[model samples]
Target: MSRDGSPPAATQGPASTGFIPGNKIFNRRDFVRERFGAAAWDAVLALLSQEDQAQVASVDPGAWYDVHLVERLISAACQQLKLDDGLLMEMGRFDADRELSTVYRWFLRLIRPSFAIRHMNLYWRRSHDTGTWRSWQNGPEVSAELRDWAVSNRAMCITLLGYLGRTLELFGGKLASLEHTECRSEGHATCIFRTHLELPADEPRPGRRPTRADISSLARELAHSPNREALVEALVTLLRFQFGCSWVEVWVTGQEDRMQLMGVSGERGPGDQRRFVLEVAGRAVGRLELELPRGPGQRGVDEVLAELMPWVSIALETARVDRSEPHHVEESELARRLRRAREIGQLTPRQLEVLELVARGKTNKEIAAVLGRSEGTVEVHVTNLLRKYGASNRAGLVAMFWGEL
Candidate 1:
């Protein structure tokens, strides 16, 4: 998708069966070979050839390739350089200049046009002479396996780091540091690449990390939020402050599979952002999105989100229940009893299927046949239902669940 949240069709070149037209002009492999020398390039190719015979047979540097192949080649290159993941990632953080940014953007579009890559300027300090400028390169389409490999290896992303480092060098900035704060492989919906400019020694340090007390207080506030709108607002505010994000928004599934914007915080940038689904009772109900900023303090946001989502779910469910009209106003006392009984029973989904069959006057053998479970398992479900609901037998369990229309 484009950075504006539109489909790739807007920027897409002429459609072709093999490769997107004009995309073959920029070959990342060729760029690497020219930059790093022939020996390093040959070593990377040897590793790629070992992994896939097809790669060896038909090595076309100018051709558009799948993301998986690119990732494999990068992994191999990392190995050949004899650089640990830390050094490799460190190599990615170079100074950013306009020419470097333009070249990087071209390479990104050529290789992964489907990704939403945007460059944003950061406000460092009031003094313009300090030149403590920072920029961010956000890639939402990063592969999960690559992210996982980075996290497990305690390494930075080689592809993005390499592009950023080279761009910085072209801009006359020495490589300082690069940090991958958020990663899809680390349970975030997007990969955030933060670039810190090589500031002078006299420059002040960046802001301090968000305190644990601040996060805990936000969690408490979310839990106590009176309604869904309030809950959403609290969440967006907390995330924006906690992460120093460019923007944050909540999108919930409304009627007809459409997404409804619930709340937003910070400057609304282009529509391109990362989306994380919010699930309840094994069903997707909403999504949380973020346009992350170029800064620090993203290390524990995932864990914080994990801790806070239950409250968000509860608030959403409460709002849904409030908006829904009562359908059981004319229900009989026996029907109400059955409903309460089921609520108190706490049956598993499989057990509930068995209960529905029992209510249909099905025996254990019949339920086993219908549900594809063994007769023994069906018997166990029935027994648990009876015991949980204080029923003496299968008929009593049925009486607790069955009622007139």
Candidate 2:
């Protein structure tokens, strides 16, 4: 939870009772004040015991405080606020974001999740004095176990759950599965959490806005496109691949004020979504909508849309033809085939280039010439391609490329 990378003071005496950083208690109180106003936080204090009331008033952000009092304050606030218990995660997420403002939070976010899980206790220990947090990271799967952590209730556990999830978001990871498999609240001796995070190192992090260079590249690609559908496809593909949008759609407004779906990209997955109005010369031309893999937003949509204004403006104008339009643009058969082969075979970059050139009706020599590789290397790639495709020769490869026997 100390993601701000600012290590807490080591002034916590070795005490039997659990002690947490005073900043956390202060942050929670501040959250109540910011969320429900100052009077609401005062109401929360009135509900607490006299001992807790005094401690809450004089809590020092630099000192360690009793977690028991903090837990009670949380209970009273929740009861008075009538907040859904699930909002505890939201509160935790808010706490995580607040830490992002600290120096070195960026470094923490950039490290791999595996490293974070392995060394998470170093930071947790800075704030928590009574619990042993153990973690095991196996490839993409992470298992976290908390031992000797005795809390009055599960409220703190749920808040930590939200905190962990938000930290993963900052690390640019998408959770395929996250579950509190075991909890002290459930009569388990040690709390346990299981998680599977999808971190594709080759793929750009989700929630990042398109860069200026990315928009420039998209403009160049769109410039060479022959037709309206091709333009739409180019824009959709770039958004999906470049910035990790799960779904992208562009809708063009016609002369009569009717809207037409021009193009789409990526499978519609459950995630966060943003919608933007595309304008040209101050007139609304179309809408650019996209969904990112579900997580806290890393950047603003307006910044992303602004960077992509050049490509979006051109693509929108090109797609406004409104003639012989399909629901969406489809990739060429051969391009689709090449992409399918690349994915299915898990081809290397060179193999992908060879396969694409071959599908484009290039011979091994021509592929070598195009790729700046020797004919023998191209032949080796072609042979591997034949074996992967279950084809005997180059001729058979081409035939199978078109779904022919």
Task: Name the candidate that leads on TM-score.
Answer: 2
Tens digits of per-residue lDDT for model 1, 77-175: 555665454444434433122223442332222221111112111111110111222333332222211222212112324444654555544333454
Residue-level lDDT of model 2, residues 214-284, one tens digit each, is 45544544554445655565466556654667667777665465665655444455777888787776776
Where's the lowest-lDDT run of ten residues in candidate 1?
121-130
Query: How many pairs in model 1 have backbone atoms within 3 A of each other, for residues 3 or more apart or on separate chains, i.e. clashes?
Result: 2
- What global local distance difference test value does model 2 have? 0.65
TM-score, one value per model:
0.27, 0.46
Off by over 4 Å in 1: 1-40, 49-53, 56-62, 86-156, 165-177, 198-405
Colliding pairs, model 2: none
